[model samples]
Each structure stands twice: as structure tokens, then as C-alpha cells.
Target chain A: MDKPALAAWLGAEITGMALLSGGAIQQNWALDVLAGGQAQRWVLRTDAAATLAVSRSRAEEFHLLRAAHAAGVTVPEPLRLCTDRSVIGAPFFIMRRVDGLAAAHRVVRSETLAGGRQALVAALGRELARIHSIVPPRADLPFLGEPASDPCRRFVAAMRVLLDAGRLPRPMLEWGLRQLEISAPPPAATVLCHNDFRTGNYMATEAGISGILDWEFAAWGDPHEDIGWLCARCWRFGGPGEVGGVGPRAPFVAAYEAASGRRVDPARVAWWEIAAAIRWAVVAIDQAERHISGAEPSLELALTGHIVPELELDVMRAVMARAA
Target chain B: MSWDGHEAPDTRALLEIARTTLMEAVIPALTGDARFKALMVANAMAIARREDGPAAAAVHAAVRELGDVAALCAAIRAGAHDPGSADHDRIAASLRALAEARCRISAPKALG
Candidate 1:
């Protein structure tokens, strides 16, 4: 979209605009605007060329951002959602842009983060607890799909469906899913799960977490699902610690329990961690399929698919650890 | 380098050169996303080089012995390799080997 059109639409003067990288499924534009005779920075989020099957629309993401912001969860303040595609050739939303680093490699490898990692982990745990506190059965978040009656069983079924539909057969994933199904834990209390909570999904500063980003895959499921996903080996980005690759899992869990007033089961978290690896592997396969099928020819997507073996190894190791 | 009935710089050799050039030359010159993409390119070329070399042979031998992945997946899915069963360890070992081979191609650093 042209700056003039966007400026007219927002009744603001566009000073600067730049497309931010790092988002694979969506486009984020950093825009400096002179609105109400004051200079302000905003982020414009829109759909990418292609997106995953489970992502939410721009309007839905806007609503989710608003809900999260209201729930004391640090999130970019959603300003406006433009559902009219005519404005930008696609639906988009504008929000207050916060300054922080969201790069996985940087967050995992930055030496300066040594002091902040503990606080960041604890803060992330508290923030996640706050997010999970947003229970559903509400009229506002109608976009959220129905809560999974049994998240583990549902995940196993979904994995099977994904595997069966694909031409490629993943024996390790199949075995891992079977094990998960066999020892599936009883469903815990359902809540608003940030289904993609992981190391790279949030922004962090030297002080602490700036904001949690990417709510495209948000769903209502067991809270442990998010916890496991956060601690999953595949999402650790080769970091040393398990708490989102930043710190030990204990402080994070303790902070979470303190914030939520609920106890977390380590064994259940381990089960979901194994499931998380399989889930990521399936997603990676789908990403590669997008590239192979000429739907979205991205080298990143193709390379992403190659990570499935590592994920499969993780699943096997997790399963073995459980058995031991 | 000598050529008998083939070119001196084979595909694998070409890929290795490309990867080394990208990592040592192009990557250092770039910054931010471009550098990251360059690293990925280097990794891809390295994997291709490995695949073009002896990696494919080992993988094929394993596949020939264990049958195709589809059959193994089907068997595992059908409860043939149930955890703790007699066949489970063998199946797990095979899968681990397959994963290690692929990792050697994709990200050998991960193997450590």
C-alpha cells in the first residue's frame, strides 16, 4: 500500500516505513506516523503470501492482541484493525511498536542476557500464567475454536491425520504419537493456550520480556500444552537451559505456580514435550510441502523441513527418557 | 585433479566449493537477514554435497535393509514396534541411525 493512501486512511502523516523481517507467515511493517500532531511509531501486520492452515486472520489477531493487553499480558497495544482489503490489498492491523529483540539466535546466544535470563524466564512464566487465565466460553473471542475435550488425544489424532494425508511417511513421528496416545494423561483444566509459545515467539529486552507476539495459533487447550511447547527441545535454539533456552525450568514453573496458584505436573509436562516435538515436525513437513508443491517457494521453508530429523530424534530421546 | 571419463570438478566438489565460498566470502560481507539467508544457503549446499557423496549410499543401504520408511511407519503405527517389546529396541535403533544420517547431512553440529 502507498504511504499517501495509508496516511489518508489513518488521518496521519507517514514519516517513515520499513518492512521488518523474521516473520515467516506474516508481514510486519514499522511505520513512523505524525498523528494528532505528534510523532509515533506503529507496526502494521498483514498476511504473507501464504500462511499456515491454523493461523488467525488479521482481525482475529487484533482482537487477540487487545484481549491479551487487557489481561495484563505484555503485548503490543493494538490500535486499529482494517478489515477492508481495499486499503492495503489485504486486511491488516496497526499496533504500537515496542522496541526489543525477537531473534531466536540472538536471544539464545547473546552474552549480555546472562543476568536477565532468570528474570526473563520468571517474567515469561508469569505472563504465560496471565495468558492462561483468560478462560473461554465468552462472546468476545468467538474466533477461538472450541476447547479440545481431550488435548492429548486430539493432538494424537491431528498428527495421524497430518501424517496420513502427506505422501511422506514419518516412522519416528508415528511411533512417538503412538506412545503419546498410549500414555496420554487425563486432560487438565482448559484455558486460553498460546499454542505456539516458544523461544522465538516473544520479544525480550535486557530488562525483561517486552511483549509476547504471534497469536496466530492461539487455542483453548490444556495449560500444560503451552508450558511443554515453551520448554520443548526443538524450540530451544541450541541454548543450554530448558526454560525457553534461557534459564532452568524450576524458577519458571515456580513463578507460574505462584502466579496461577496451581501446581504443575513435571511428568505431564514431559509427555507434552514429546508431543510438541512431533507437532513441530508435522508443521515443518507442511512448510516444506508448501515449498515443494510450488505454493510458496521459500528456501527457509525447505530448510525448515530438514529439521524434522532432529525433531524426530528429540521425540525418541524424550520417549526413552520417560521409559527410563 | 585428473579426469578419466568424467569432469574433474564433480557436483559434490562444486557444492563444497559453493558452500565454502558463501560461508567465508558472502556471509562475512552481509549483515542481518541476508547473512542469515547466506548461512542457510551454505548449510543447504553442504547438505547437498554430503548427499551427493557417500551419505546417499549409506541411507540407501539402510533403507534396503529396513524396507521403505512408509512400510516401517505403517508397521510401527500398527503396533509392531510397541515400546518395550522385543522388536522395539531394533526399530528404535534403526530410526536413530536414520535420524543421525540425516542430521549428518543437514546439521552435523547438532550431532555433538
Candidate 2:
């Protein structure tokens, strides 16, 4: 849409605009505007064409966001959701603009931010514990499903589908399947898991975590899945001795244990961490397919493809080590 | 230089060529496409640049070192090295050694 049309629709004069990173499923924008001569900022999130396949509809995402917010997870407040494709050529949602930073690389490496890394990681663990405490609605949330007894089985099944589709490494497939059989974690109480909880998906300031962003992958599952994912090595950027590339694993786990009043099982967390690596590998391949299939020829997807082997190696090494 | 006999060029070599093409060819041609298309190209470029610049070398070095650790484990299993009789402790020591080795490799220049 043109600037004038967007201004008319938003009822504000747009002063500055910056395009945020667009994922496979959504286009995001940072819009600075003036209303009644007072400056305001809002995030404009719109669906990308490819996102229609794997994503919940805008209405569903909005509803889920509302539910999650009500359950007390820190998130950007939803303002308005517009499903009219005529306005912007896609469904879009507007939300209150959040301040602070989201770039993981910057946060992990910067000396200024490095000092607070431990505190931030601990805070993140507590926040995740809180999110997992939310009870799934019996019927109102139609999309939420029961937690599987063996998430590894589900992962293996999904990987088989992808492998059968071709373009995936056979060795990695075999290795993952073997690992799944040998190193599966014991089942625990199912709870709401922010499936994509990681460094890049969160907003942070000097004080600590402000909000967790990106809810497209949220689901009902083993809560420890989120914990392990948060500590996955891939998400650690380049920071050594840090779980999420922020701080040591002990503090992160300790903070969660203290907050939730439950013993954090190291073995279970390790299992999920390995699973997290495998999941990333699968997602990386999907991103590569997006480029190779001509749906969206992105260097990002191609680069993402390169990481699959590394991820596969991590998964193999972790699982093998655990088995031994 | 070849660790596991895979004939394909290492990730570093492959990504350098791809990154060059992306920056010199693809990014400049992204005008007038749908917003999503443009975004995809841009995101792709970011990933390519990151891989070409830092992640490729870092991951390659890490993997090669891990392979060495695996070889060490094999040696210990064959009784070539006295890593102790306890299998669990042997594996744990090997892993710790690998982690320390990885930490010594200078942080990727590009990531800096």
C-alpha cells in the first residue's frame, strides 16, 4: 500500500519507517508515526505468502496472543488485527511497539550487555516456567493438542516424511532415527511451551527480559522442551560458557528450579537440547527448500542449509555421548 | 585437509561464492518485487553473508576437532590409550577435552 493510503487507514502521519526482518511467514515493520502531533511507534506485522502453509491464520495468532497475554507471559500488547487483504494485499496485525533489543549476536557479544547476561538468562528461565504454568483451555483453544508421550517419535516421523520428500542427508536421517530410539526422554506433565523460546526471539533491556516475541510455534508440550531449547548450543551465538550465549547453564537451571519449585532434571534437559538441534536442522532444510523451489530464492535459506550438517553433528554427538 | 573423505567442497568454500553472488548480483536486483519477495532476498543475503563470513569456518573447525575426539574415543576403546577402565569417565574426559579445544580457536573474525 502507498504511504497516503497507509496513513489514512492508520489515522496517523507516518514519520519514519524501517523494515524489520521478514520470516518465511510474516513481514514486520517498525513504523514511527505522529498522532495529534505526538510521536508514537507501532509494529506492523503482515503475512508473507509462504507463511500461509505452516502458520495459523491472523485471527488464530491474534487469539492465541490474547490468551498467552492473559496467562501472564510478557508479550507485545495486541492492538488491532486486520484480515482485509484489500488494505495491504495480506492479513496483518498491529501491536504496541516494544522497546529494547532483540538481536542475539549483539546482545551476546557486547561488553555492555555481557555483564547482565547471567541475570538475563536467569530471568528468562523464570519467565519460561511461568509460561508453562498456563492451563490449556478444554475447548476454546481448538489448536492446542495433547502432549505426545515420545516427542522423539513424532520428530522421527516428521523427519521420515522430509527424507522421503528427498533433499535431506540419509546419514543424518538414519542417525537421528537411531538416536531417537536410544535416547528418548521420560514423559512429563504436558504444559504450554513457547516452542521457539531462544535468545533471538526475546526482547531485553538493561533491567532484563521485557517480552518474548514470535508465538507462531507455541504449542502444548513437555515444558522442559522449552527449557532445553533455550539452552541449545546453536542459540548461544559465539559466547562460550553460556547456555543461550548469555551465561552459564547452572544459573539458568537453578533460577528455573528456584522459581518453579521443581527439580530440574539434567538428563531430560539434555535430551531436549539434542532434540532442539535436530529440530533446527529440519527447519534449516525447509528454509533451503523455500529458496531451491523458487518460492523465495533467499540467501538466508541457502545459508541455513549449510548449517544442517553442523546441527546434525551436534545431535549425533550429544545423543551418542548420552547413550554411552 | 580432507577429514572424512567427502569430496564436496567444505562449507566455507561454497558459501564464499554464494555470498559474492548474493551481494553483487541478487541484492541489487530486488527492486519492485512484492514486499515478501524482497524481504526473502534480503534475509537470504543476511544469512549468506553470516555463513560466508563467520559461521562456516567456526563450524568447520569445531566439527573437525570433534572428529578428532571421536577418533580418540575409538583409540581408547581399542586400548591404544589408557583413558582409564571406566567408560563413562573416559567419554566425559574426552568431551571436556574437545570443549576446551574448541574454546581456544579464536572467535570467528567476522563475528567480532
Candidate 3:
């Protein structure tokens, strides 16, 4: 579709257009518009020409945003969803623009941002707690409810399927299965978990966290799963300290504990951290497959293959450390 | 051996060329592509730069360390120092301790 046509369809003056990023499923843009003679910036997310297999539909993603936002999680509000392919040649959605940075390397390296890292991390923990506090059975979201009985067992089984299909390293797969068998956490209160809770998935301002992004993987699970995922070393971007590379583990856990009135167990957290590494390793291998199959052929996907072994090593090291 | 001794170009050098081509050629032509495709290209370039630079050495060193740990575990299993009865748990624990120490001294550095 032409720019003029899109402008007419959106019913706003397109002042400036900047391409944000592209993935397998969608193209994101920072659309600067003059609406009612007032300048505003909004995010334009549209589907790719070649559809992706794993992406949720635009309507589903919008519904998830509304549900999560109404549950008091910090997420960008949905402005409008356009499913008319005639307008833009694909489905798209518009959301209120969120202000803050998402670059992981910049967050770790900028000395100016260093002081606020701890507070931001603490806020992240508290906000994650709030997200996990949502009662999935009561919510009207699509991907709610636990997966059968014994989520860990089912999770391990799913990983095994990926392992079999992807031909992942036997040692890492074996080690992960062994660890899961030995150190299964007792069941806890279930809630809506932002499965992709990590540093890059959040937008932060000096004041605090502004919004959480990426709800495609959100589901109902043990809340500590989110906590362990946040504190995982792979997501820390090499920053010193455990709390998402911002600071030590104690403060982040203390903040979460204070917010949710639950004790943070180091052993359980370590187990989940190991699980996080294994999960990332599996995803990295899958990304590599996507590149190899020419589904994406992205340098990110190619390089992701290299990180799997490192993650395996981390998983082994974490498990071993805890056993000691 | 010389730095260029290998017959095939090293992984780092190959990734460097790919990264350069992507940044200089591919990115400019990606303007009309969908947003997801453009983001993938950008992320690919970023990852390529990292792989061609510091990440190569980091991964190489890590692999070597893991190899060493495996060798140590084999030795312990073969009755060489007993590693306190030499169970899988004991071997894993010892390796973890070693890795933790290394992480303390040389934490993974960020991509600049």
C-alpha cells in the first residue's frame, strides 16, 4: 500500500515515519503523526508479508495487552487495531508510544544510567510481582490456565520434544533432565506469569519502569518462574551483580518479597535459573534452525547458535553450585 | 602459528565481512521491507559485530574451560584423586565452584 493510502486509512497526518525493527512475524515503526493539529508519536506494529508460525494474531495480542494492562501491569495501551488487509496489505495495530530505552548494551554501559539501575531493577521485581499476582482463572485472557498436572514435568517433556527434533547436545539435555528430576520445586500458588520477564523486555525511565513489552509468551505458571528468569545470568548482559546485572540478588529478592509477602528461597531460585538457561539454550538452537532453513537467515539467529553452549555451561554450573 | 595459518578464514573474520556487507549494503535496501524484517537485519548485524569481535574469544575460552572440566571429571572417575567418592554430584559441584571463581575474576564483558 502507498503512504498516502495508509495516511488516509489511519485518519491522521503522517508527519514523519521511521522504521523501528522487523522480525519474522511483524514490522514495527515509530509513526509520528499530527492528530487534531497536535503532534504525537505512536507505535505502528504490522504483520510481515511472509507470515510467521508462532506469532499470535494482532487481535489476540491486543486482547492480551488490554487484559494485562487492566490487571495493573505496566503495558502500552492499545489505541486501534486494523485488520483490513486492503489498507496496509497486512494486519496491524497502533499503541500509545512508550518513552524509555530498550537497548541492553546501552543500559549496561552507560554510567549516567548506572545509579538508577538498582532502583529500576527493584521496581522491575515489584512490577513482576504485580503481574504474577493476576488470577488467571478469573482473567479473560486466551493463554491462561496451567498446562495439565505437574507443570515442571510437562515443561521437561516439551523440552525433550524440542531436543529430539532439534538434535540438541545430548550432554546438556541429559544434564537438564537429570537436574529437573532431582530438584523439582513443590507446587505454589499459580498466577499469570510474564514468561519473558527480563531486562530487554522492559522499558525504563529514570523515575522507574515505564512499561513491560512482549506478552506473546505470557501464560499461567509458578510466579517464581518469572523471578528466576529475570535474575538469569544470560539476560544480565554481563553486568556485575545478580539482579539483571544491576546489583546483587538480595536486594531484588527483598523488594519482591516485601511487595508480595513471600519468602525468596535461594535454592528454588537457583533451580529456576538453571531452567531459564536450558530454556534459552533450546530457543537459541531453534533460532539457528530458522536461519539454516532460510526462514529468517538472520545474523542474530546464526549468532544465537553459538550462545547455546555457553548457556548449557551456565546451567550445569548453576546446578552444580547449588548441589555443593 | 601465524594468525592466518588456517586454510579457511577464521569464524571471526568471516563474520566481520558478513557484518560489513549487511551494514553497508543490506540495511540501506531494507527500507521498504516490513518492520520485522528490518529489525531482524539490524539485530543480525549487531550480533555479527559482536561475534566477529569479543564474543568469538569468549566462546572459545568457555569451550576450552568446559573441555578441561570434562577431563577433570574423567580423571576423578578413574580413581585419580577420588573427588570425595567421585559421584556425578561431586564432579558437578567441583566444576561449578571452578566456574564461579572464573566468573568472579573475568565476568562476561558487554558488546560495545
Candidate 4:
């Protein structure tokens, strides 16, 4: 909705509205609302100019956020979901804007963070475990589909589908996916896995992580999937350390095991890390195609396509390392 | 019509100048959102400069024998170059060369 209309709907006066950056699929606006002589700040999230094929709608993300909040996961408190497009020209939701840096590059390199890297990574591990604690069949999260019999296979198949849909066969990605299929581990325990639970997706302060953002890619799968994705090299943003470019894998895994009471297999984590590279590579190509296909002509998207080579190299190097 | 003797700047030189101008002069003056957008513009210009340079062509030529990345990968996926085979070593080396070429243009520091 327009600011004035939204203000009326909320029974408040609009103090200010500023667009916030860093949402590729959504546009976030900092909404300053004054109601009953009280000032409050909120975030209004709506659709981007062009949305990714894999992203969840704002309504779905709202429900997911609510469920996560109820499960004790750190997330922005979702206040309302407005599905009527006429209300805002597109679906949108509002949440209390929390403080912290969610930028991946800044989060990894920021020396301002206190308690050092160990505390930050440990907090992230704990948060991820809490998110996994929210299992399915709940009344609130009926949209979460059934668990896959072999989640790895299903994941690889999904990548293949994306590649086929692009009509541009990518051999390196296909090779990695084929290897993943061949070495697909037997299904481990299924839980809610934040498929993109990496360094870039969470917000952290100098004290520690404030909240985990972005739930569009959450899925029912092996919990270790989240662990591996978090530690993947690509998400490290060229940092020296692993564990989301903050620390070693040992402490991160230890923290997660402590929080969830689940034993982690190092080999399985490595396997999933390999899968993370392949998945990211495919996504990179898809992002590039959005520009190349004239769907969205953006310099960022064009440059993003060029990143596929780097991701493909990562995939090859990862597979070779595993073999070695 | 008389032509001027002075040479015009090529695309790479022009892009480099634009990038440096944004970074050194324009960026320092910009703040907040404008600064961020200027940074992005500078980055895009830098990439354009590199992409317009000969290094990008070297990347293409490095993998020219492979027909295309997709075809090369298809060969690898089809078991024509499994890890233990002789073809695997050749393919791996070619891929390494290709990767090095790409990183040189996109992220030269990463190659180091």
C-alpha cells in the first residue's frame, strides 16, 4: 500500500519510509510508525522487480518466520501478512526491524564483533539447531511438504531440473550432480534444514548473532545439510577460516552437536559441502541466465553469470579433494 | 574533412579511467546510499575493463580445444575421463588451466 494508506490501515501516522538494501528477491523498507503518541520502527518487505523462481512468496515467508519465532529461533517478529495485492500492488509483510549486520562480506571481516569468532560461530550453530528443532505436521506450518526418501537424490534431481529448464546443458554441474547421485548417502534423520544457512543469511552484532534471516529455502532434509552448507568454502567470502569464514569446522560441529544432541559424521559433512558448491554453481548460472535471456537486464546479473566458472572450479577442486 | 591527430581512448582505457574517477574522486565525496551505488558502479566498471582486456580472450582460447564448458563437462560426466583413467589427468589439467584463466580475469588475487 501507499505510505498514507498503510498508515491509515495501521492506525498510525507515517513518520518515515526508507528503502533498505540487500534483498535480491524482496524489497525491504524501514517504516517509522507513530501510533498513540508512541514511535515504532518496522520493516515492510515486498516483492522485487523480478523474483527468483525458487523464492517463497511473502505470505509463505511470513508463516515460516512466525513458526521459527515460536520455536525459539532468532528471527524478526512477523507482525502481519497482507496478501491482497490491491492493498500494496503486491503481497507484503511487516516485521520489527532488528539491529545487526547481515551483509556476508562485512560480517566475516568486521573486527567490531566482540567475544571473537568462537562465540559468534557457536551462537550460529546453536541457532541453526533450534531452527531444526521445528519438525513437520504442525498446524501452523502445513505448507512444509513431506520429507524426501533420499534427500540428496532429490536435491541433485532438482539441480538437474533447473539445468534442463535453462536449456543450456552445463557439464561440470552435471558431472558434480552425477557424482553426488552415485555417492548419495542413505537417508539420515530428517529435520527442518535451512537450505541456505550460510554466512550471508544471518544478522550479527558485536555481541553476537541477533537473528537468522531468509527462510525461503527451508526444507525437510538431513540436519547435517545445514551444517555442511554453513561451512562451505564458497560462503567463506575469501576468508582464511572455514565455519562460515569465522573458525574451524571442529568447534562449529561440536557446538551444533551440543545443542541438538546429534552426532555429526565428518565424512557426511564433507559430502554435503561438495553438494553446496554444486548447488551454488547452478544458482549462479541461473542468476546469470536471468540477464542473458532478457528476463532482467542487470550488470550485477551479467557479472554474476561470469562467476559460474569460479563455482565450477570449486566443484571440480572439491570432487578431486574428496577422491584424493 | 580534416581528421584530428589525437587518438581516442579505447574501451578498456575509458573504463579504467571511469573506475578510477569513481573510486578516487567521486567515491570519497559520496556517502551512504550514493557511496554504495558509486562503489557498485566502480566495481562494474573495473569488471568491464578486465572483461574488455585480452585476458578474457585468453580464457576462451585456453578452453577452445574443449569445444565448450558444457561439452567438456558432459565428457567428464559420461565417464570418458573417470578419476583413475589417463584421460582423467588430461581433462583435469585442462580444467585447471581453464580455471586459472578465469580467475586471472575475475579475481586475480584469488589465483595467488
Top candidate on TM-score is 1
Categorize the docking of model 4.
acceptable
- Judging by DockQ, tell me the better candidate of 1 and 3: 1
True contacts kept of 3: 0.12
Model 2 TM-score (2 dp): 0.72
Candidate rank order under DockQ: 1, 4, 3, 2
lDDT score for candidate 4 against the true structure:
0.79
Which pairs of residues collide in candidate 3? A21-B35, A22-B35, A22-B36, A22-B37, A22-B39, A23-B36, A26-B36, A27-B35, A27-B36, A300-B44
Instruction: Give the TM-score between model 1's chain B and the true chain B.
Output: 0.81
The TM-score values for the models, in the order shown, are 0.95, 0.72, 0.75, 0.91
Candidate 1: fraction of native contacts reproduced: 0.62
Q: Which residue runs of candidate 1 sit more than 4 Å off their true CA positions?
A: A111-115, B1-4
Could you report the DockQ of all the candidates, in the order they appear?
Answer: 0.68, 0.08, 0.14, 0.40
Residue A254 displacement in candidate 2 (angstroms): 2.2
lDDT of 2 at B15: 59
Between prediction 1 and prediction 3, the one with superior TM-score is 1
State how far residue A163 of model 2 sits from its true place (Å).
2.5
Off by over 4 Å in 4: A112-114, B1-8, B52-54, B68-72
Q: Give the range of the ten consecutive residues with the poorest summed lDDT in model 1 chain A.
A: A110-119
Task: Compute the lDDT of residue A169 as modeled in candidate 2.
Answer: 34
Backbone clash total for model 2 is: 2
Interface Cα RMSD for all candidates? 1.3, 9.0, 6.6, 2.7
